[model samples]
Target: MSFSPTGQAQVLVWAPEAEQVELILNEGNTSVPLKKEEFGYWSVTTDLVSPGDAYKFRLNDDQEFPDPVSLFQPNGVHGASQAYDETSFNWEDDNWQCPLLEDFVLYELHTGTFTPEGTFAGIEQKLDHLLELGVTAIEIMPVAQFPGDRNWGYDGVFPFAVQDSYGGPEGLQRMVSACHQKGMAVVLDIVYNHLGPEGNYLGAYGPYFTNKYNTPWGPAINFDDAWCDGVRRYFSENLLMWFRDFHVDAVRLDAVHAIKDFSPVHILREMKQQVNQLMETTGRTHYMIVELDLNDTCFINPLEEQGYGMDAQWVDEFHHALRVTMTGDQTGYYSDFTGISDLGKAYKDAYVYDGQFSPHRQKSFGVKAEGNPGKQFIVFTQNHDQVGNRMLGERLTELVSYEMQKLAAGAVILSPFLPMLWMGEEYAEPNRFQYFVSHTDPELAEAVRQGRKAEFGMFHAQGEAPDPMAEETFLQSKLQWDLLPLEPHQTLFRYYQTLLKLRKELPALKHLDRQNLEVVENDAHKTLQLRRWHDEEQVLCLMNFSNAPQTVALPLNAKTWNLVLDSAAPEWKGPQPSAPTANAGTEVLMQPESLLVFRGQS
Candidate 1:
C-alpha cells in the first residue's frame, strides 16, 4: 500500500482476471515484474522509478497503459505517467491571505481555454488582469488529470494528480503563487462524486464508489457503505493536501448533490469541520463552496442549527431568471421562467422557483430561501455548465444585444449576492465552451460523441452537432487574449471593472442584507425594479427586459435621485442614452434592454 515520495511509482496492481502484470518503463527499455499478493495486489519497486519518469502498466501481453493513479502526465493523458517534484518550485506568497467569503468576487475560468497556451503558466501571466478587474478570488476549473489533455475537468479520474497538459502539480503551485502575489485568492474545483470513465483505478484499490444511491454520473461514491471510513478520509486528506501542498485558498465542490452519505455525521459536515480545524491550525481562512441542485439553505446555515456547513452555494435560480429574461428562450429549464415577475422574485428572494410548480421538472420544486444573506448565494448570468450544456455552446452575446449583455452584467455584479463572472465573459469572447473529452478507448470516445449529440437533440433540431473529439472544438474554445485590447471588448472589460468597484465602494450596493431588498414588477411590459436601502443610503435598480422602451412609475419618496450607472450609456459604449431623468411618483422612461441604477440624495 506504499506510494512513492513524489506520489508517483504506484508499483502495484490487482487484476485477478490477468495472469501477469508488468511495469513498463520509458522508451520500452525494460519491464519490472510485479508479484501477486494473497490479498490480490501486484507489487514492485525500483529506484529508477522516480518522479518525472514516464511509465505505465502492461497487463499480460497487452499494450502498455497509463497508471490509473498517475500523479503527473508529462506527455498528456494518453502518455505514460512521469515523475514530478512538487517541492522544487519556489513560492513567494507567504504573506498572502485569502479574502473572506462575504467579500469574494469570484471569476470562474477554465484553465484549458483561459489563454492561448492554456497552461498554468499561461494563466499565471493574466493574474494582473483579474486583480485589476477587482476579483477577490479566481475559481479555477478542476486541475485533476482527466482522460485526455483537453477537458472541462469534470471527468477527472485521478483526483490527486494535476493534468499533465497543465504542467502537473508544479505548474499548479506556480499559478497559486502568482495569484497570491497579486493579492487574489485561488479556489480549485474538485470532484469527489464520481471519477471519469477512463484511467479510473480507485475501485481496484478499494471501494471508492458504491451502488447504494444513483447519480447522473453513474455509481454513487461509497461514503456510507462498509469500509467507507477510509474512503471518506481519503477525500478529506486530499482537500488538506491541496491547501497544504499547493497553497490553494479554497475548494469549490463540483456537483456535491451526487455524493450520497447516510452516516451518523454526513461527509460534507465532517469535511467542513475539518476545514475549519485546519483554518485554526494553519492560521488561514480556507473555505468550501458547494454546487448543489437542492435549493436548501442548510448548507450555508450555521452548523449549530443542524445544517451542513458551507461558505456558499450557486443560485441557479438567479441565472435561470436572468437567462430567460435576456434570451426569451423558454426551452428546457428556461420553461419555468416566464416574465419579469420571476426575475424580480429572483432579485428579491434569490430563488424564483421556490416551492412553485415547475413546468420543466413537472413537479413542485425548490424550497424557500428567505432570511438568508445574499452573500450565501453565488449568482452568475452564465457559467460553464449553463453555456457548455447548450446545443451549440452559444454565449449570451450571441442571443442578446450588447446593451442587454451589459445590463445583465450590471444586474449580477450590483446585486447583493456574491457575483461570479465566467472566463471570457468580460470581453465577450466569441468562441463557445463546448463539451470536450479525450478518451483512450475508441469505442468510449464514439459513445461520448454520440451521447452528447443525442442529449442536445432533445432541445435543438437543425444543425449537425459539433464533434466533441474534433481538435477544432478545443481550439475554438481557447480564449482570444488579444481580443481584450479591442474596442467593445475593452469597453466591456472596463464596465466589469467599474461594476466591481461600485460593489466595493457603494455602501448600499455592498449590503448583503436580504431583508432590505424590495422588488416592483410590471409583468405585462417585461420590466422590474429592485430597491435596496441600508439606513439612509438607498439605491434603486430598474431593468427593462422587453425590446422596446417603457415608462414606469416611481414609488419612492425622494427629493432628488442621481443617476449613477446606466447599462445603455455611452460610458458603457452601448447604443442607449447616457442618462435618464425621473421624478418622485412620476413615470420615468427606461430604455429597452437596459439596467439603470439610481441613488437617493438629500
Candidate 2:
C-alpha cells in the first residue's frame, strides 16, 4: 500500500484462494513471487518499484488484473494500476473551513455536463459564478473512475481513483483548492451499495461480494458475510481516503437503503464514527449526507438512538408534491401525493408521507420527521435523479409554465429545510438531463440500455425510452450555458439571485427553525401560505397553485404585512403584481401560479 525510503514498495494483494501470486511490473517483464501470509494475504517488498510505476498482480501464474484498491488508474481500469503519491499535489486550503450547515444553499451538479469541458478544470471555471449565486457548497456527482471518458459516474468501479477523463487526482485537488478560495465547500457523491459491471475485480481480491444478498446491480457487497472484515476495511478506507486525501468537506452516500448489512453495528454507523474521529483529528467540520428512499429517520438519527448518525437525508416528497401540484400528473410513485395539501405538509413538516398510507407502495411509509432540524432534511425541486431518470429526461421547466417554475424556485428557496438547486436551474437551461452511460464492454452497455428502457414500463410512459448508451444522449443533456443571458432566461436568473439574496439578508429566513414553522392551505382555491418566525421577526410565503386567481384569507398576526417579493410582478414580466395589502384577519387576492413573499412584525 506504501513505499519505503529505499524506494522499495510493500505490495500486498488479498487472494485467499490463490496458491501463488506474483507482482508483475515493468511492462510485465519483471515478476516477483509474493510470500503468502496469515488469513489470505500475499506480500512482497521490492526495491525496483516506486510511485507512478504501473503494476498488476498475477494470480496462480495465469490471471492478471489491476489492484482492487488502486490509487490511480492512469491507463483505465483494465490496464495496470499506477502508484500515486497523494502528497505530490500542492493544496492551498490550509486555513479554509466549511460554513455551518444551516447557512448552506447547496448546488448539485454533474461535473461532466456542468460545462462543455467535462472535467474538474471545467467546473473550477464556474466557481465564481456559483459563489455569486449564493451557493455555499457545490455537490459534485460521483467522479470515481468508471470505464470510459464519459459517464454519469454512478458506474464508477475504482473507489480511490478519480476519473481519468475528469483530469485525474491532481485535477480534482485543484478544483477543491479553487472552491476553498471562494469559501465554498465541496461535497462528493459516492456509491457503496454495489459495484458497476465493468472493471469490477474486487471478487478476485477476497470475499468482497456475497451471493447471500442481491442488489439491483448484482451480488451485494459482503458486509456481514463470512470473511467480511477485510471487505469492510476496504470500503471504509476508501471513505477515509476521500476525506483525508481529497480534502472533501462532505460525502453524499448514494442509496444506503440498497446496502444490506445484518450486523450488531451497521457499516454506515461505523463509517460515521470513523469520520467523526477523522474530523476530531483534523480539526475540521465534515458532513455525511445520504440519498435514501426508505424515508426512515433512522439514517440521520444519532448513534446512541440506534441510528446511522448521518448528518442529513434528501427529502424528495417536497419535490413530488410541487411536481404533482404543478403538473397534476400522478403516475408511478407520484400516486401517493395529492397537490397543495401534501405540499403544505412537506413544508410544515419535513416529509408528506411520514407514517402515512402510500397508495404507490400499497402500505404505510416513512417515520415522523418533525423533531429533526430543518437543515437535516435537504429539499430540492429538481436534481439529477428527478430529471435524468425520466423517460424523456425533461426538467421542471418542460413540465410547467414559466410562472409555476418561479413558484417552484420560491417553494424550495423559502422552505425551512436546506435546499439544493440542480445545475443550470438558476438560468433555466433548456437541455434535457437524460440518463447516459459509456461502458467499454459492449454487452454491459446494451444491458444498461435495456434495463433503463424496461424501467419506464412501470410508469407506462409514452414513446420510446432514450438509449442510455448513445453519445448523443449525453451530449444533448449538457447545459445550454449560452441561453442564460437570453431573454426570459436572464429574467428568471435574476429572480433566483434576488431570492437567494433575501434568504441570506433576512434574519427570519436565515434563522430557520423546523418545529414552529406553520402552514395554512386554502384547498378550495389551491392556495397555500406559510408563516415562519425567528425571535421577533416573522415572514409569510403565500402562493396560488391553480390556473385561476384566488382570494385567500390572510392569517397575519401583525397589524400590517409588506410584500417582499412577487412572482406576478411586471418587473419580472408577469401579468400584474399580486401584492398582498391587508391587515391582520383580512383577505388578499393571489394571481394564478404565483408566489408572494411578505415581511411582517410580531
Candidate 3:
C-alpha cells in the first residue's frame, strides 16, 4: 500500500481465488474496481483516497476485508485498513550506525507494559533509564496488529501493521529514531510460523497456510506447499520493510523451530540471503537473531559452510541449565538438565545438549555447535517466555533468594556469549508477567484459558493459573518502576550496573573469544570456574551455587588475581564484610549462591 500527498492512493492486493475485487474508501462511501494482473494480483490507483484514509478490499464483490498487507490498522484489526505514507515521517538516523553484534547488551521489553502510558511514546520517555542501566540495545516485543491491546505479540494477525493502540506506524518510527539518536539499537521480535486465529484473512486471498505441517499454534506457513511463492515473498518483504522503513537494527525471529519447511534451500537461508543483499545495497549493518529450540549450528554457521547465515540464536538451554542449578525444581523440560554440569557445558559449548539423549525429550537432541563463536548464542535468565509461561509468571527473584538473583545475573553477564535481561529484571520488579489478551470473541477467549491450563499440566504445582482473559492479568504484568528506590532492588540494580561496566571496560570480558576460554566444574561443591583471556589480560569468574560456602582454587599461574566486583560483598548487601582477593595457587572462599570476579595481571 502506498499513499500520495495529493489525495491519491494506490494499492496492490493478491487475491488469487477471487473473481473480482473492489477498493472501498471512506467507510464504504466510495468504491472503485481493480484490474486483475498476472499471478493473481489486483491493482488500482485513485485520487479519491488520501493518506490516512481508511480502506478495505471487497472480494468477488461479496464480502469486504482489510488489506492482507495493511501497513496501519488505525482502527482495530476487525476494522478497515488505513493508507499510510511511509515517506511522511522524517528519520534522523541517517548518520547512525548500529554497534557490532558481539558488543550488544540487550534488554528485552514489551511496549505496552514498559510504561504507564503503554505506548511507543511511553517507551521513549524511559530511554534514560535504559541508558543508565548500560543497555546497548533494546529488544521490543512484537508491535504487529493483534486481536486486542494486550497480547504477547505471537498472536499478531497482520505482519506489516503496527498495533494502533501502541501509537501506530508513526509512533514506532519516532521511537526507533529516538533510540538511534541515543546510540542504542532496537531488536523487534516477529512471529512467522503461524498467524493468529482471530482477524486473519490471508486464506481469503490465497494459500498462505498449508496443512502439510502443523505448529503448536496451528497449520504452518505455506513455505513449501503449492503456490507458496507469494507466501514466501509476503514474509520476506515484511522482513525487509522493518529494516528499510523502520530502521530496525535487528529482528528476533520468534520460534523458528515451529516453522517446518522441506525445501532444498530452507526459508531461513533464503531470508538470510535476501537480508545480506539488503545490507550490502544499503551499506548498513543489520542482524537476524532467531529464537530456536533446536540446538543446530546450521542456523548460525557461515554461509560458505553450507548453512543458514543467521547472525545469532537465543540459546534456551543455557537459561534452563542455569535455572535448574539455581532453583532445582526439576519439572517439565528442566528434568533434562543436570545443574552446574550443564551450565559448564553451556559455557564451553554453546549448547548444553549436544547430541545427548534427554529424558524430557526421550530422544537424542541438538548437534554440536563446535565451530560457532560465542557471539552466535544469546543467553538470558528471565525472558518473557521463561517468566510469563510459568503457572504464576514468577520472576527469578521471586523464586530464589536475593543472592541467587545476583548469581543468575552474573551467570548470564559473565559468560562468553552475548547477554540479555528481561524487562524489570535489573531493579527486581515484583510484578508477575502473566499471559494476558483481550480477544473480542468470547469462545476464543475461553479456549485460550483452557490452552494455558493444559500447557502447564506437567508442572503439578498447587493453585490454578491466572485467567488469560482477565484484565487484572494484564494489569498485573506491568512493570513497577517505583521499585528502583527500594531496599534490595536498588542494590541489585547497582550490582548489574557494575557487571555491565566491567563487561564493557575489561579486556578479557570485552572480546568474545570462545577459543581462549576454559571452564572447570566441581560437582561435589556445586561450583564452576571460568577463565577467559585476550592478548595478555585475563579474567576469572568463580561461581558457587551451593547452599553452603565453598573454597575454589585459583588459576595456578604467575599472574596475581585482584578482586574486582563480588556479589558477596557488603556493598551488594551480602553477609561478608568485604570481598576477598587471591593470588595464583591460592584458594578463595565463596559465599553460598554468590559470584566473584577477579582481574589478573602478571
> Against the true structure, whose TM-score is highest?
3
Minimal lDDT window, size 10, model 1: 1-10
* Residue 503 in model 1: lDDT: 85
Poorly placed runs, candidate 1 (over 4 Å)? 1-70, 75-88, 458-460, 576-583
Residue-pair clash count for candidate 3? 0
Q: Per-residue lDDT tens digits of candidate 2, residues 499-536? A: 99989988778877886588888778888889888877
lDDT of 1 by residue, 428-542 (tens): 8888888787787899999989898888676565576789888898888888888899989999999889889988888888878888878888878888888887888888888
Q: What is the C-alpha local distance difference test score of each model?
A: 0.82, 0.87, 0.90
CA RMSD (A), model 2: 1.7
Write down the TM-score of every candidate: 0.90, 0.97, 0.98
Pick the winner on TM-score between candidates 1 and 3: 3
- TM-score, candidate number 3: 0.98
Model 3 C-alpha lDDT per residue in residues 1-602, reported as the tens digit of each score: 77666656767888777899999987788899999988888898788777778889999878999998898997788999988887788999999999999999999999988899999999999999899989999999999999989998888999999999999999999999999999999999999899998999899888999999988888899999888887888999999999998999999999898988889999999999999999999999999999998898888897899888989999999999999998887888999988999999999988988898988999999899888888899999989999998899998878998988888898899889999999999988989999989899989999999988887776556678899989899988999888888988898899899999999999899899998899999988999999998998889989999999998878875368999988988899998932466679887888998999988878
Alpha-carbon error at 453 in model 3, in Å? 2.7
> Model 3, which residues run further than 4 Å from truth?
4-7, 457-461, 577-579
Candidate no. 1 TM-score: 0.90
